[model samples]
Target: MATSFNEQFDQHGAWRREFSLRLKLLAEWLKDHDLLDAAVAERLRRLEIQVRSDKLMVAFVAEFSRGKSEMINAIFFAGYGRRIMPATAGRTTMCPTEMGYDPEVPACLRLLPIETRLQPQALMEWRMVPEKWTRVDLDVNNPQQLAQAFERVSETRKVTQEEAHALGFWHPETPEDNPVSDAQGMVEVPRWRHALINIAHPLLKQGLVILDTPGLNAIGAEPELTVSLIPQAQAVVFILGADTGVTKSDLSIWREHLLPESDQEDIRLVVLNKIDTLWDALSTPEQIQSQIDRQKASTADILEISPSRVIAISAQKGLVAKVTKDAALLEQSCLRQLEDALGHGMLDQRQKILGSAMARGVSHLRCETERVIQMRKRDLTEQAIELKGLHGKNVSVIRHMRSRIAQEQSEFDQGGSKIHAVRSVHLKLLREVFALLGSKALKAEMAELTQALGQKGLKLGIKRSYSDTFDKLRSHWTRVQGLIGEIQSMLTAMFRQLNAEYGFALQVPDQPDMGACLAEMEEVQRSHLQYLSLGNTFKLAQPEFAERLVRALSTRLRGIHESALGDVELWSKSAAAQLDVQLRERRQSFVRRMDAIDRIQQAAGGLDERVQAIDQQIAHLDQLEEKLASLAERLVSAGDTVAAAQEPLSA
Candidate 1:
């Protein structure tokens, strides 16, 4: 049997996974060879994360009752053998609902209360507290429980005019924009501001995020969704009611929201939903096609795009067909064409996106590695020429050069003790710094912070808990700073000693900006109190939130620790380089004088042997240069393949 569209999507996902792994391996290779600069390697590492973790965000935007949720259920969650999302007969999924898999959090429906939006704190910070969100446990096997849990998104609450104003839902000039007021003048509004469905669905696990948004009001109120989510989405599917063609509200959404945010024409898809209404049993197939083609042309004209971009489908029929395994209904649904578009359009586009991203990261590194290799080859070529020129001379000259070499060797041998002393000092300073920033101590401190943040049943609430936790973390930062200063002092003393004893004037470079290392953590601290409030006990207790907070803080701490270690390593290498330079200068001076003596003594026997030895060294350098060049070529070619590679779905 031919591969189904769903299986093809899985194959595409597997391709991405395989590509990401290859990039990871290449990053390690670059690091191992020291081919790229440290920053380049870091960029590669970050790219690996984006490749591996970034979900293909497909947002479904429409007015209520357009079957947007049903489309999502049919296309992605059909494997469940039933409708997983709440797609009832009437208006369902009233809020801006997001279906995803947060591996850190368990399967549950986390709903943020609409009232929480009125809080002084930013939405993201407010979202951090679990207690602020209503948690509904979801059992996948028990479809009833799952269905009930998801139904909460449609829940509503009634509030007085004053209460609505307090919740930022009422504006005097735009009074009509507020939820319809009853005879008593109380406004009925959605109970939840946002619904996050965390489920163990296959498509979600494969990194698919479906954003089902209601009307403009919800999208307008939620700045995060408009400013961040919509703009970042990989594809935005705008749903239009086939019966209504294009309503005023739909036009407003198309003009105001979707069009402005989605810059890529290919990523934006127009779905004329409820197409089953267009299906007439008495009409010929050509007649139906003619109507659809006209609708497609009209939609394309309205949206100012090619007619091919508009897709007509019956999401309800699609869902029913998939659930019942009825091929006829499925074909009537025209969902296969939509799936084909998604596979070829969005999924194919994702490969290009990943490729372009990877190319941007790897190109410079490849060029630089190639340059370094070529430069080394040039230097070796010069050395080879000089060695070949030294093939013949007098015996007396050779003996005199040997005597001078002996004298220089004695002087070189004497400087070894000073080299040892400098090295010892550098090693001692590095060891002490690593000991102070030991992983065990850092891990223990992080564990304590996690425990404090995890403290349940706090009378003072989440704000106080985070405040206390951050303060403790700040103390650890202070201790780390003090130890870093101590290490700097030791390095300075060591460098000063070397300069005084040897007249080398070696200076320890100033320490890198430690403040910059902890700057991200400090920025988070400045507004830590703004993150949590009195009513976030449950939000604070969520395993996902806890793990995320811990991971973020731990990453910063690790960065600082790594920064300190890097600084030490850099300083040590600098000190050793200076010593090597002085030693090389002394030896070179001795060799130059010895060459003059050899000329005077007329001793140049065995010069051919010297030439042969030099040739062997040149051959070794040539092989190394060739290997480096080959690796650079491979990196560039791999980047090209990644950038251009696409998995074309069967039409």
Candidate 2:
């Protein structure tokens, strides 16, 4: 037996819930590790927000009277035993409508004023101000209240040609196709710019958001709908009448609006709706089947999608069948297959999106952190090797250090004068380095650098922004180079003095190359400039430029600065530590020599215990290295699980 629509929806909900939980867990892990930096964190946070807030948006698009609303009714609202959304024939759903559940807001139908279309802000921005919309309370269980409130989508207002133009309805080239004018030359337009119905339904509250959009005129009038909302949806169902598949208006809506959306066909499902219209009273079953097949194939060809994607379904009949508990009629309506397709195809893709986010947040961060741990482990291993080598040659080295200390002590006891001289040199070098390239100097300059990038004319001025930001970064980089040279010179001189005075071998490491650092900044700058230049005409794109550009610069500069500081600090500390160790050896050398002769007598008896202790430490480090390696494997395995779950989404 085929699955019921309710069962499919429930399964979809279950899968989504599990996917959401996994994403939340991944987010928590990333947050704990402090790896969710601003750049990578946004996508992870969006997934977490969508899961927690239940905002998986699915859109239905079609020309007027294509049974798009009916499909929604049958698949989702049929459980109510009647249509919950308006699906009446002949120009129903005049405005674009959205159905979702907002837990914070009361269940209601809110309509934005059509006059607001003249404003420059996006529709999402307008939603923030509740006073801009007309609200009507809704009780979900009450059919009459829902029916009454839903009628607002079909509400119309008479407007003159000038008023129509201002609302984005009348273009000079398409004057003839404008809404049929009355005797007074007044055209009718939708009274509401947009309608949002917040329903208190389990599926809606379980992360199912639906967009029910109208035909060509409504879509063309709204730029935000085409640019932002539709593209962001998990799936788009494009409905067409089976009897008249892919009409001119339908094609227009598909090409002009839906086609431009990202992952157009990948996330799109074309529905040949109103298949009941093709049923003939006298024709044989085979003839009807052949006719429907021909329509599906032709529609697929017209839409440039596979035939398997063009589904035929009688949504009106499907609603009646499900409500009346008629199995045969329900099967005949073909709604079950469509439901499965949506449940498997669309819901699966949604799950993949969540899974991908989890992999990014968890696995990517785990790998980066593990890499740092591995580096530290390597450094520790080197230190351990040095200790082992020193232990093996302890007798001979201590004898030589013993005689040198006796000679030094005769000259001066405690070596206080030598220690003070070394410390003085280290302090002077540190002060000079901090003065030039300290965090204070770098941070103070960043504000002015960012402001210079943001200062522009009425246009985005992408070229000027890039030029100024890059120049500032270059100057900062040059200063860092100069500081590195100064530090390098100080270290070379200081190390030479320590070698001559204390007879220790310590050398300065090569200065970090600024070329790679500069290249990274240039690359980020180019990407930001490219993004801003592409959509410079849109005011919405302006804020993104400022936010992304600053973030890019800050992240790259912070990385470079940290690298420079690490290099300089590591070299300086290593030199000071080596000097101090030599000085301590000089002071303790004679005592250790006397003690070494006694220790040799004692070790002659207890040598085995000491060797055993050394062996245990070696074994412990080996175990630790193995454990870290195993952890890296686990991280990879966890990432594979998410990828495996995503595999079926493409099918």
Give candidates' CA RMSD values in order: 12.0, 11.6
Q: Give the alpha carbon lDDT tens digit for every residue of 1-651 in model 2.
A: 557645765665665555555555555554564333342344445545654564667799888888888888898888788787888878889888999898899999999989887664557667789889999999888987797789889998999987887777766655655787899989899999899999878788776788998887776666556645675577888888997778888887777545643432237778998888889999988999999999999998998888998889999999999899999999999999888887767666655555454555444344433433333334334333433443545667746644654675676454467657756766775666655556665555555554555555535455665576568657766765776677677767866876676554545545556665566566455544544453323322334334333543454456566756655564455445444444544445435334443454445534344445445745654654454445434433433454433332210
- My TM-score estimates for the predictions, one after another, are 0.64, 0.60
Position 374, candidate 1: lDDT: 48
Please name the candidate that would achieve the greatest TM-score relative to the true structure. Answer: 1
Clashing residue pairs, backbone N/CA/C < 3 A, model 2: none
* Backbone N/Cα/C clashes per model: 16, 0
In terms of lDDT, the poorest run of 10 residues in model 1 is 642-651
Q: Tens-digit lDDT track for model 1 on 414-435?
A: 8678657756765775666676
lDDT of 2 at 126: 72
Task: After superposing candidate 1 on the true structure, give the runs of residues whose Cα lies further than 4 Å from its correct spot.
Answer: 1-8, 31-37, 127-131, 137-144, 175-177, 301-306, 378-651
| Candidate 2: worst-modelled 10 consecutive residues by lDDT | 642-651
Q: Candidate 2: where is the Cα deviation over 4 Å?
A: 1-55, 260-265, 368-651
